[model samples]
Target: MRLLIADDHALILDMLQNFLEQEKDMEIVAANDMQDAISAVSAQPGFDLALLDYDMPGMDKLDGLRRFMENNSAPPVVILSGHAARDVAQRAVSMGARGFLPKSMPAQSLLHAIRFMALGEKYVPVDFLFSSDQADASPAPDGPSATALTARELDVLKALCDGKTNKEIARDLGLREPTIKLHVKTLYRRLGASNRTQAVMIARSWGIY
Candidate 1:
């Protein structure tokens, strides 16, 4: 398989390069940032897959993933994110990423994800895909439900999921901090979360991000 790997950290880039190089059938192209990744992919066509980082400096994950798909729709994309949340993983999958793996996972797991995603199968932690409903016998939904938040609230929630502070979110969405706070308060009440971290976790389960 010919793969394009994009990440910002030099150490990680080297580690991945070394590890994947061991696979005699795999040819790897590496890039340090979003722009470099874009150029590399464009310059080297017919890549079988792309292993992308969700949070890279100046790289918009969704946008970059879309661009990559626009060019190469046959080969699936797999996302590697340091941020661990079901919602982010779901979002990446919804956006055409065949697999989503957290950086905290072992290298073997990463290899497994790559192998599975190359086959056009979904890869997510099993726990994230199943929920127990012991009392009702009905299986819980795949993740948290987004029905609790309004359209605007969802926009707010999405910004929050990206690790943006309230002030930063307000500026990005062209709203006042007070307005953002009001929405946050309402979101917390709806999700039954008392803090930003909790809210993010719940929202992630619901795939709101």
Candidate 2:
């Protein structure tokens, strides 16, 4: 498969390129930032897949999807991030990315996720599949206050905790993106989370997710 990888880190770029080169059927097109990735995708043709870093200098987050969409190339983009929160993963998938893989995942798992995504499959972290009952088994200190979110809000927050974007959260919950965005703002205020990562960290610490 013809593959492109965009990451700001040289070591990661080189390592991934070298590793994928050993596969014999893959070709590497490299980019160090979101802009470079976008340019590479636009200039080059017939890329079977792309691996994008969410925190690349130019992209910094979910912005790469806007550029990808603007370029009109949907080559099964996979978001690879160092701080792969549930909200980011969900958001990447929602923004039309083919898959989401954490940078911390094992190399084999990353490869497996990429290969599976290439075939139009979805992947979720095993840790995220647990039921809320299990997740919230620890009793809330003040009962409702500790678990204050309404069921829908909690659902939205869980998706956020999973690194899902507002659009993705909307899709997953069958709500409008605007509505999800509202929920997210409310969640941020309620949880004192300034960003998705912070919200997730706070929730985990509070045993809310």
For each candidate, what is the lDDT? 0.72, 0.72
What shift in Å separates residue 47 of candidate 2 from its native position after superposition?
Answer: 0.7
- Say which candidate scores most in TM-score: 2
After superposition, the stretches of candidate 1 with alpha carbons farther than 4 Å from their true spots are 72-74, 128-209
Candidate 2 residue-wise lDDT, 157-197, digit = tens: 78977888888887887867766666666567567678889
The whole-model C-alpha lDDT of candidate 1 against the native structure comes to: 0.72
Residue pairs that clash (backbone atoms under 3 angstroms), model 1: 87-204, 144-205, 144-206
TM-score, candidate 2, is 0.60
